[model samples]
Target: MATTEAVKAKTLLGECAAEFAGTFILILFGCGVVAQVVAGGIGDHDSIAWAWGLGVTMGIYVAGRMTGAHLNPAVTIALAAFRGFSWRKVLPYSLAQFLGAFLAALVVRWNYTEALNKFDPGLTRKSQIVFSTLPGNGSTELGVHLWGGFRDQIIGTAILMLLILAITDLRNTAPAANLAPFIVGLVVVGIGMAWGTNAGYAINPARDFGPRLASFLTGYGGAFKDQWGDLYFWVPIVAPILGALLGALLYDLLVGRFLPISDEDEEPGRIPEENTSA
Candidate 1:
C-alpha cells in the first residue's frame, strides 16, 4: 500500500518538478565544464564531452523514478510522439526543462563571472559562447553557415533519439540493472566526440535556448545572433525538435514495430515488475 501510494504521489506537478531538477543537474555540470574550458582554461574538448555525458547520467539517476528524466525537451517531445507519454504534459514538461536550464545557466554565469570577465573583458559575443552554442563553433575558418548548422543539429539530434529508443526498448537489448542511463550517457559522449565541432552538438533545444536566453538577459545582448550578425538562435531550437520527431518515427518504423511483445516485457523505461515493490 505504501509503495502504491508513493507511486501515486508522482503527480504531474511532481513529475515536472523532477524534470526541472534533473535538467538543472544536467546543465549545471555540462555548462560548468564548458565555462571552465572557455573562461578558466582548465579543460579541453574531451573534458567538456565527458563532463556533459556524466552530467546526463547523473541527471537521469536523479529523476528517473518519478519522470524517467526526460531532461531534454527533445526527449520529452519525442517520447510523447513515439511512446505512450501524455501529449498534454509536453508543454508543461518542456517549460519546466527550459526553466531548469535557464536557472542553471544563470548559476554557471554567477560562479564564473570573474573568469569570464577576465577572459573576454567586455562580455562580447565571444563570451556568450560560454553560455550558449555558436555556429561553426565560433570558428571563422570553418565558414559553417545557417544551413550547415541546421543540418548538423538535425543529424546529431536524430542520432540521439534513435539510440535512446534503441537503448530503452525492452524488446531490444536494453541494459540490465539500471545501466541504461550510463549507456545513454556514453551515447551522448560519442555524439559529442563525433559531431560537436560543427555546431556544438546541441541536440537538445532547451539546452541551447535556455542558456542563450539567460545570456541575452545578462550583458550579452547579442545572444540571439552569431558573430557574423546572423540570427542563428532558431537553428538549434527548430532543428532538434524536427530531428527528434524524425528519429522517433524512424525507430518505430524500422525497429519498434518489428519487435515481438512478451509477458515479461515492460514499457520503454520502466523497471521490471518484480522490482516495482522493492
Candidate 2:
C-alpha cells in the first residue's frame, strides 16, 4: 500500500517538481544562448531570440502534463486571476519557477565563468547583461529610462498573456494536432523580434529576476542597479505581473466573454490536452 505522504508527494509536490524542472530547462537554454552571444562572440540578437523561444517550447513539453508548465510567475498569477486557476497553487508554482530559474542561471554562470572573465574581466555591467536585462541594452546614449523600460515590459507581457490565453482557449482558433506549444514558442520568438530592444523584452518576471538575483549574488555588482546608479531590479518583476493581469483582463473582456459557448469547451482555468503544455 502506498503511504499517504507518498501519494501527496506525487500530486502537488510532483507538479511543483515539474515546474522546477521545466523552468530549469528554460533558463538553461535561454541564458545559455545569451552567454554565448555575450561571452563567446557568436550568434546575434536573432539567434538569442530563437534559442529562447525553443527553450520555452521545450520547457512547456517538460512540464505541461504535470503542471501546465507555468514556467513564469506572471503566467501563474495571470492564470489564477483570470482563468480560474487555483489561487492556492499560485505561490507554490511561482516559487518553483523562480528557484528553477535561479539555479539554472547559476549553472550558466558557472559554465561560462571563463568566457565571462575573458569577455569582461572586471565583471562590469556589460557582463551582467548575460545574466539579466539592462535598459537600452546598456547603451548610455540610447537614453532608455526606467519608465520606458517598465512600459515596454508591460506592453510586451500583456501581449504575451493575451496570446497565451487565445492560443489555449478551445473556443478560439488554436493550433491543431498538439502543436500549441510550438505556436506559443513562436509567439515568444515574435515578441522577441518585435519588442526585445527595450529592456530585452523581459516580459516574464521569473525569467528576468531569477537570473538577476543570481547575478547579484555572483559578484555582478551592478545587477541590482544599472550603470546610471539607479536601482532597476523592480521594473521587470512588477511590470510583467501588472501586464499579465492587464492582458488577461483584456482577453476576457474583449474576446473570452464573447466566445460562443459550447459543452465541448473546457472549464474556465482548465486548459485542454492539446494546449496543456503551453
Candidate 3:
C-alpha cells in the first residue's frame, strides 16, 4: 500500500509538470503571435486572434487529462474554493503555472529577437517583452480603458467559467469532453474581437503576469515594471475570481441543485434489499 501511494504521488507530480509545460507553450505561442502582429511587427489582428484561439484549444486538449488544463491560476483558485478540490493543491498548481508561463515567454524572446530588433531597433532593448496595456493617451484616459477592459474580462470569464462547470457535470461530462476546447477557444475569440483593443483581453492572470515577467527579464531591460503602476492589475486577478465564483454559484443554483446528487455522479446512496431465506 505504501509503495502504491508513493507511485500515485509520483504520478501527480508528473501530471503537474505536464500542466506547466503545456501552459507555457500555450502562452508562448498565443502571446508570441500577439507580440508579432500587434506590437509594431508583421502579423495582423485576425492572425493573432486565431493563433491565440488555436493555442488555447490545443493546450486544453493536451493537458486536460492530467491537470484539468487549468493553466489559469484564477481557474485553479476558484475550483479549489467552490468545487471541493483540496485547497492544499492550489498553491503548487498556481506556482507551476506561473513558472511555465514565465519560461514560455523566455522561449518567445529567444525565437523572436531578430523580428523585434527589426521592428524597433531603438527600442530593441524591449525585444523579449510580451504585450500588455499601457495608458493609450494619459492617466485620465487610463481610467476609461481600465473600466472597459475590466468589465469585458469579467463578462468573458464569467461565461467561460459557467461553461466549464456545466461541462464537468457527470451527466454533461461526455459532451463537455468533446466540446470544452472549442467552447473555450470561441470564448477567447469573442473576447479578442470585443475587448482586445482596451486591455488586451487578459482574462487570465497567469497568462498576463507570467509572460510579462518573462518579457521583463529577457527583453525590454525589465521595463515591464513600468506598467505595474496602472492601478488595475488587480482587476485582471480579482475580477476573474469573482466571475468564476459567480459562474460556479449560478451553475449550482440552476443545474446542480436540480440534480439527484449534489456532487459527483455516483448517485446519492444505495438501497439495501431484504433477504427472504429462512
Candidate 4:
C-alpha cells in the first residue's frame, strides 16, 4: 500500500507538470498575440482571436492525454464539481496553471518591452489590455451603468463553457479522431468574435489572473487595483468560475441525462468512479 501511494503521488506530479506546460503554451501564444497586436499595433482583432484559439488548441493537443489539459482554473474546478475529478488535485492543478500563465506573461513582457515602452508612455491602464482584461463598456449603457462588465464576463464565460461541454459530449455529436481539441479551439474563436469586446472575454481565471499578477509585478503596479482606478479585477476571476460551473451543471442536467455513459477519454473530463466519491 505504501508503494501504491508513492506511485499515485508520482502520477499526480506528472499531471501537474502537464497542466503547467499546457498553460504555458496557452499564455505564450494568447498573450503574445495580444501584446503584439495591441501594444505594437501590428495585428488586428482577428489575429488576436485566432492566436488565442490556436493557443488553446495546441495546449490541449499537448497535454490532453496526460492531465486533460485544464489550463484554466475554472475548468479544473468545474471538472471536480460534476465529472468526479479528484478534489484533492484541485489546488495543485490551479497552482500549476497559474504558474504557467505567470511565467509565460513574464516572457511576453520581456519580448515586447521595447514596443510597450514606445506605445505606452506611462505604462498605465492604456497598456494593460495586453496583459489583463478591462471592460470597454464599463461606463456605457442606455445611459451609464457600472455592472455591465460583470454581466458581460459571466455571459461570455458561460457561452465558452457551454460550447466546451457541447463539443466534448460524446453522447452528442462530439468530434472524433482526436479532433475535439481543434473543434474546441473554434468554439473559442466564436466566443471571441461574438462577445470578446465586452470585457475581453476572459473565460478562464488563470488566463487572466496569472497574467494580471505578472503585470502587477513587472510594471503595471497594483494590477488588481484597477487600470481605470476602480479595482474591478475580481469580476473576471469570480465570473468565469461561476459561469463554468453553471454551464457544466446545466449541460449535465439537460443533456447528460439523455446520453449514455461514456467510454471515451473525451467524456467531459470525468474521472473513474473508483477514483471519485461517486
Candidate 5:
C-alpha cells in the first residue's frame, strides 16, 4: 500500500511537470508568432491572428488533461473565484504558470536576438525582451490608452468567462469539454484581430508580466526602467484582475441566479434515469 501511494504521488508530480512544460511551449509558440509577425515581417494580420489562435487550440488540447491548460493567470484566478477549483492549489498553479511564461519569453528572446537587434537596435532591452507599455505622449494620451485598454480587456474577459462557465457546466459536459479549446482559441483570435492594436490584448496578467520581467532581465535595453513606470505597469495587472472578477460576477448574476433552472426540473424526484436492458 505504501508503494502504491508513492507511485500515485510520482504520477501527480509528473502531471504537474507536463503542465508546466505544455504551458511554456504554448506561450513560446503563441507569443513567438506575435513577435515574428511584428518583427520578422513575414505575415499579415490574418496570418498572425490565425497563428496565435491555432497555437492556443493545439496547446489546450495537449495540456487540457494534465493542467486544465490554464496558460493565462486571469483564467485560473477567475476559475478559482467563480468555479470550485481548490483555493489551496490556485497559488501553486499560478506560480508555475507565471514561471512557464517567463521561461517561454526567455526562449523567444534567445531565438530572435539577431532579428530583434537588426530591426531596432535602439529598442530598449526591456522592449526587446517582452511586451509592455511605453510612454506615447504625456499623461493625457496615456490615460486614453489606459482607459481604452481597460475597457476592452473588461469586455473581452467577461465574454470569455461566460463562455467558460457555459461550456464547463456538467449538464452540458461532453460538448463543453470537447470544444472548449477551439472556442477559446477563436475568442483569442477575435480579440487579437480587434483589440490587439490598442492594448496588445493582454487579457492575462501573467502573460504580460512574465514576458516583461524576462525582458528586464535580458538587458536588451532599459525599456523597463525608462518607459514602464509604476503607473503604467500596474494598470495591466490590476485592471485585468478587476475585469475578470467583474465578468465572472456578471455571468453568475445572469445565468446562476436570474435564469436558474425552475425548481420543478431540479426537484429530487423529477430527474430522469437512463433505461437499462435486461
Candidate 6:
C-alpha cells in the first residue's frame, strides 16, 4: 500500500509538472510575440497568429506523453464531461496552468518593461492589452460592445473545441503518425485569423486570467475590469468553459455517436480487458 501510494503521488506530481511546463512554454512564445508587436514593433497579426499556433504545438509536444497535455482548464473540464477524464484532476491542472501562465507573464513583463514604458509610459490598461484581451474598436455604431465580444468568445472557443475533437478523433479522420498536436496548433492559427481581433480570441482562461492577475499586481489596477464599464474578466473564463462543453456535445452528437466506444468510456477504475492466460 505504501509503494502504491508513493507511485500515485509521483505520478500526480509529474502530471502537474508537465501541465505547468506546457503552459509556461505556451505563454512564453504566444505572449512574447504580442509584446514584440505591441512594444518592439516587430510583427503583425499574422505573426501573433503563428506564434500562438507554434506555442500550443510545442506545449503539447512537451506534455502530450504525460497527463494528455491539457493546458487549458476548459479542455480539462470538457474532457471530464465528454471524454471521460477524471473529475479529480481538474482543479490541480487548472492551478498549475495558472501558475505557469502567471510566471511566464512576469518574465515577459520584465523583458519588455522599458519598451512598455516607451510605448505607453504608465502601465495602464492600454498597454496591458499585451497581456489581456478587450472588445473591438467600433467599426460600426459605438463599437462591437461587450455582448458581441462575449458572443465571439463563445463561438470562437466552441470552434476550437470542436476542431480539437475532430482532429484528435481517430475514427473520424484524425491525423496519422502522432501529428494531432501540430494539427491542433493549426486550428489555433485558423481561429486567431478569424477571431483574434475581437477580444483577442482568448479561448483559454489561464491564457488570459493569469496574466491579467499579474498585471493587476504590477500596478494595472483592477485588471479584470476596465474603465469602459466592462466586467470583462469573467467573459474569457466562463465563455470558454461553456463553449468547450457545447462543442464537445456537438461532436458527440454528430460524430462521436457513430464511433466505437472503447475502454476509455469505462469509469475511472473499471476498465475491462480480455484475459488470455492458460
For residue 180, model 4's alpha carbon misses the true position, in angstroms, by 0.7
The residue ranges of model 1 lying beyond 4 angstroms of the native Cα positions read: 1-10, 269-278
Over 1-278, each residue of candidate 1 has an lDDT whose tens digit, in order, gives: 88776774456677789889999999999999999998898989999999999989999999888777888888888887777676777888899999999999999999998999899888886778777888888888899887889999998999999999999888999899999999999999999999998899989888999999987887887889886889999999999999988898889899989999887665653334433322
lDDT by residue for model 6 (12-73), tens: 77778989999999999988998999888998989999999999999999988776677899
* Candidate with more favorable, higher lDDT: 2 or 4: 2
In model 3, how large is the Cα lDDT of residue 124? Answer: 34
User: Taking the candidates one at a time, how many backbone clashes does each contain?
Assistant: 0, 0, 2, 0, 2, 1
Each model's Cα RMSD: 3.7, 3.1, 7.1, 2.6, 6.9, 4.3
Tens digits of per-residue lDDT for model 2, 1-278: 46755665457677789899999999998999999999999999999999999999999999987776789999899988877777877887899999999999999999999999999998988888887887887777888888888999999999999999999888999788878888889999999999987788888888889999998898887788876778999999999999999999999999999999888876434545443322
lDDT of 5 by residue, 1-278 (tens): 89866765564465456556656876776668767865788776787667767867876787676666766667767767776554554565667767877888889888988877777676553234234433331233455455665676677666666666655544433253388788778877887687665555667777667777777677644533323343455555666777777877886777655554543332111112221000
Residue pairs clashing, model 1: none
Structure candidate 6, residue pairs in collision: 138-143
How well does model 3 score by local distance difference test?
0.64
In order, candidate lDDTs are 0.86, 0.87, 0.64, 0.81, 0.62, 0.81
On TM-score, the candidate that comes out on top is 2
Answer with 3 or 4, whichever has the higher lDDT: 4
Using alpha carbons, what is the TM-score of model 6?
Answer: 0.91
Q: Which digits, one per residue and each the tens of the lDDT, describe model 4 over residues 95-162?
A: 99999999999999999999998998677777888888877733233332226667877778777777
Q: Where in model 4 is the C-alpha error above 4 Å?
A: 137-146, 262-266, 271-278
Error of 1 at 265 (Å): 3.3
| Residue pairs that clash (backbone atoms under 3 angstroms), model 4 | none
Please report the candidate that would top lDDT against the real structure. 2
Candidate 5 backbone collisions, by pair: 125-220, 125-221
Give all TM-scores, in the order shown. Answer: 0.92, 0.93, 0.79, 0.92, 0.78, 0.91
Clashing pairs in 2: none
